[model samples]
Target: MEREKIISDVRSKAGGCFQKGEFYCSEAVIHTLNEFLSWPFDRSIVRLAAGFPVGIGRSGCVCGAISGGVMALGMVYGRDPGNAMDSRMFPVAAELHDHIKKLYKSTCCRVITKDLVFNSPERKAHCVKITGEVAAWVADKLLNDEALKDKIQPVVV
Candidate 1:
């Protein structure tokens, strides 16, 4: 499916961004890309997002979108579990994270905006864009990175 179509599908869904009344554009984009580039998108993002406003954000971990995007990236480029955190996933995810941070200026939700989590529609919209930009950045990065790009291709089925 086209990237926009996938984003539209996620938007129309009951809980992603529109339904949550948030303006997380990057989140929306990342979600869309996840669906387009990976199998079973919801299963991955939802699980990563679960701890977002609930545990991760309150605890000051990586932004949910970053975590979610990395999850997708790892699903594609991740190594076996034995190495875990220090594997290639970290460098790839870290590069993506740095890129996202540079693009957005900051990764903290509160820094991005002062609104409460999942409360303000405007904040959600902002998040959607942030996530979307991150997704696009990752996609572009992957496309340009020869070793990574060589691993994925248009599905034949």
Candidate 2:
């Protein structure tokens, strides 16, 4: 598949998941990446992102979509226990952080959705858009960068 189409599919799927209320911001991002990467970790890995939605479980800190993007990057660049850390991890994560910050002007959920009422359609729409955008951005990085792309070990079988 072409990289553009793959990125588009990822964006659509992540947004669709959030729009359907099947998952929150972080969950949608992580879920879409897992599926796209052929479950490099495992379906259960999504649990790690569950509490990140609503900004660290409604504490209203970092944007959940951004948080999920970081995790998605980690899935590719993170190192195993007792193994040498991948030099690319922090730089990639920082790039994602900067990307989200550049788009929204802040990585905080409270700041991003402050104008919309909680649980309102406006807020949902905003979150859904970011979820898709973040997922697509991460997909672009993963697919385009040879080092990152090589890290994805598609499940065989």
Candidate 3:
């Protein structure tokens, strides 16, 4: 498939998952990538992101969507145990972080979500949309970035 289409699909799929309550924002981002990337991670690996929603248990230190997006990038570009962190990974993650920061003007969940209460319908809808946008942002960066794409392992399954 074309990379653009794949990225678009990632956005749609992530959004769908979040809106459906199939997963939390963080899980939705990483899980969608994992599914599209052929589960490069063990399915259970998604558990690592569960605590990240609502900004590390609602303290709101960082946007869980961005954190999860970066985690998705790590699964793709992170180094193995035998080596130092891959040179390409941090830059890609930074690009994603910068993109989100530039768009929303902040990376704190509380800042981004300040207008809406967690239990409100508006908050749920907005968060679902952010989940999709973040997934697309990261996936688009990775798929089009030859430096990172070339370094990724071929999908295992």
Candidate 4:
């Protein structure tokens, strides 16, 4: 038996953006995906995820990174406003959400970070890692999911 390593800079790329204050957890996840995938979407698209940070405006609710990842998946597989919801996007969102929830053992930001203070150095580091990992996982989803690959932009490199 052999363990395989996934070679990817997306995690670090996302973490770097978060560490540099480029965006919050949710925003960083989508931004890094957009950057690496080189999608032609407008820069402002990341704004939609803005309210999700620190658990929906620090309310300590669902994880922002997961929220953002779901949005990113939508950007790729979602239906246009002109039509009803696509049958495809829901499953992708479900998979991403479930994986993220499992990884952190919960989706509530406060539950996950109850031991850390908001914006504290430790919190920043912890968030950077989590956000980056989420971004990378979403990237893998985009790159490998056969149903989505035909719909999404090709990876830049």
lDDT of each: 0.53, 0.86, 0.81, 0.76
Candidate 1 stretches with Cα past 4 Å from truth are 1-31, 38-45, 53-61, 83-88, 115-118, 145-157
lDDT of 4 by residue, 61-136 (tens): 9888888888877777777769988776898888877887788888788988999987799998988888877877
Q: What is the lDDT of residue 107 in candidate 3?
A: 86
- Candidate 3 lDDT, 38-87, residue by residue in tens: 67778887799998998887798798888899899888778778988878
Q: Report how far residue 62 has shifted in candidate 4, in Å.
A: 1.1
Q: Candidate order by lDDT, highest to lowest?
A: 2, 3, 4, 1
Clashes of each: 19, 0, 0, 0
lDDT of 1 by residue, 55-118 (tens): 2545544566666666667656766668655456678877987886787676765565545465
What would you estimate as the lDDT of candidate 3?
0.81
Best model number under lDDT: 2
lDDT of 2 by residue, 1-157 (tens): 5667778888888899889988999999998898878787788888999999999999999999999999988887788999998898899889988988898999999999999999999999999999999999988888877755655433211
lDDT value for candidate 1? 0.53
Candidates ranked by TM-score? 2, 3, 4, 1
What candidate 3 gets wrong by more than 4 Å, as runs, is 145-157
lDDT of 2: 0.86
